[model samples]
Target: METKNITGLTEFILTGLTHQPEWQVPLFLLFWMIYLITIVGNFGLIALICNDPHLHIPMYLFLGNLAFVDTWLSSTVTPKMLLNFFAMSKECKIQFFSFAICVTTECFLLATMAFDRYVAICKPLLYPVIMTNRLCIWLLVLSFLGGLFHAIIHNAFLLRLTFCNSIIVHHFYCDIIPLFKISCTDPTINFLMVFIFAGSIQTFTISIVLVSYTLVLFTILKKKSLQGIRKAFSTCGAHLLSVSLYYGPLLFMYVLPGSAQENDQNMMDSLFYTVIIPFLSPIIYSLRNKKVIDSLTKMLKRNV
Candidate 1:
């Protein structure tokens, strides 16, 4: 990972969400609570899926992995942000690597989940044969490996740039854009890599999601039985909500152009995806999913 002039800057200081002294403690408390809820919610869902025999299908399998990723993703950023509220924090390359991997993997996983829904709804008979155990495992592995590959490519490119300028990062966490802005060496290649790789990943995965859901929607509308149509909507609703919540901020932050005044908006956008989405994911799943709620209730009854 070593490159020219990289040794001198061993660490970078993060300027957290706000510089106001009054807001520090409140921000810490708020995010601390949010972090706790995110961990419990995601992990609780994982445990529920594992313990419940009914949730052993391919959909929940993908969901279990999604929950795991959400936990890791939330941990990657929120803890560091929470810590920054109390004292100065040092940013490292690992933070960037972890965040990139989680975010990239999530993009693929969401697309995979969309495909899973397509199979289940669009082709009910073949759903069983189509979404086999081996295929599900393969999909999971592909999502993870795809993320790893993307992160490795970006990290390799990032290593080429030298940060000889100010070590103070404006954002709460170690993100690629802020790092690129801070580098003394030319980061044009790095920016291109982000646009190309990140853009391609988003475009490809989002295409899959859109196509899959479009098919599912058409299938649902074609169902003559009102009950069947309702069931199909119920099945796909949670996923659609999750996708919207996950992608909306991403599109705003990465795809759209920003101005100097939008720095605060950028922070708010970052906070939404990194903190809010993870916290809300399991809630969306649990509330919208009857099986998950039933499983939780059953577990509580068993213990009580």
Candidate 2:
């Protein structure tokens, strides 16, 4: 077995979204606009929840945290990608540690949001007591701590590996999958760690959300009044939509192996989670949420 301390590759060439020169400008503009919308929408959501007294419930509390996470989650990858697209040089240097931190933070933050939902829907009466301000702060703190811990472990392991081969990455950003592919050393530990950490987080969070929604559906069905059921479903529809989009691409990318599609297809699927999902989340959640809509309307009226 050959052991090397560090690889010769100091920088990496990212393949980005496309190879065609003609499409670069158009794609750059599109992603730039999407990124802008993502920032403004998520920022607006956080601000609204913080400023509005009526929106201080457990549900909007989670939404506020989600907005905060989305801000960084999108920022972690998209800005670099957009810059690379527009810039004369497409190659960039990404610190393995920073990439790991952002990704790990996103994963845990998402799981925490799911837990918030579980508490709110599964136990409505006790929701306030269970997800109190103190508890919510603790949850957020723990999620960040957990993310930092996981990122440190992953990055430590990655930094130990040598990458003497080609420094070009097939994806837009410093994703774990692409990182693993370029590794010149044994990646068993890295693979196992990713499988264990990522799999456990996704599975556990999705299971909780699934179970909570199941109970919610049962409760709604048991209600005799059609109007009551309709209203209840309406309340949950936004969450359900957001959860599905967030989890669907994740499950596809992380849970399953890469054999399902070629590299191009895989990149497209990855885009769903990275770009599309982030953009869709605010739109779906805000549009489906009556409270947010009303809050926005009031804000707009005040401005007008």
Best candidate (score: lDDT):
1
lDDT of 2 by residue, 135-224 (tens): 878877877777678777766666656775467788777666776777888887777887787778778777766777787787778878
In model 2, which range of ten residues has the least summed lDDT? 88-97
Q: Where does the lowest 10-residue lDDT sum fall in candidate 1?
A: 253-262
Q: Summarize candidate 1's per-residue lDDT along 35-149 as a digit string, tens digits.
A: 9999999999999999999999999999999999999999999999988987778966789899989999999999999999999988989999999999999999999999999
For model 2, the superposed segments whose C-alpha errors exceed 4 Å read 1-10, 86-122, 258-260
Best by TM-score: 1
- Off-target runs (Cα >4 Å) in candidate 1 are 1-10, 256-261
TM-score of structure candidate 2: 0.89
Cα misplacement distance, residue 122 of candidate 1 (Å) = 0.9
How far is 253's C-alpha from truth in model 1 (Å)? 2.8
Model 1: lDDT to the true structure? 0.88
